[model samples]
Target: SRPWRRRLWDAVQAAVLDPTNGLPKELRAQIAGVAMAVMRECAAEQPDLEFIAEMNDHFAAALWR
Candidate 1:
């Protein structure tokens, strides 16, 4: 279960970061939501506030770019 969740997280990150994929804005927003949800879930389990903030910052920057 943990391995699968990690894989899902990795895949979401890759999709969000791929610049040439030409994903629609709506779809990208949905993907970003998923990524945030995953991060929140992981943070709940581990309580890594700094890592969570870093991930949120990175995600926001990617969204703007």
Candidate 2:
């Protein structure tokens, strides 16, 4: 079963924040940066779908590039 979005976000933030998670420094920063943006948007009363989609696109590009 898949985890909920909130749970997934928690895991991602933990990995990015943990120094011993073993992710490369640059990669961790990238993930943390995107997570922060997404978190902020999600906190809004009415989250913007377009912004979330754009962030997803950018993150996917970074990952696949």
Candidate 3:
């Protein structure tokens, strides 16, 4: 799954708190967009997910980034 949650959360935190973590400006702009896309895709694929639990899962998954 390309470590979607990790990548997503890392991207978000980077954009929020670290503006110059070695990433380029343009690529940084796409961070939030990509994160949202990944979260949406994951949610869609797992229709039976418990919303809060799954969301927590994603946050936990992000920690492994």
On TM-score, the leading prediction is: 2
Cα lDDT for residue 40, candidate 2: 76
lDDT of 1 by residue, 1-65 (tens): 34454454667767876776688867877776767676566647565656655666776698699
Best by lDDT: 2
Q: What is the alpha-carbon lDDT for the whole of candidate 3?
A: 0.56
RMSD of each: 8.8, 3.8, 8.7
| Model 1 Cα shift for residue 46 (angstroms) | 7.6
Candidate 1 regions with alpha-carbon error over 4 angstroms:
1-4, 46-65
- The sequence of per-residue lDDT tens digits that candidate 2 reaches over residues 1-65 is 12243454566778889988888999898888878777777767777768877877776686798
Q: Flag clash pairs in model 2.
A: none
* Ordering by lDDT: 2, 1, 3
Q: Worst 10-residue stretch by lDDT in candidate 2?
A: 1-10
Worst 10 residues of 3 by lDDT: 45-54
lDDT for each residue of candidate 3 in 1-65, tens digit (9 for 90 to 100): 52553554555645644755676766655655555654565557453335534665765786699
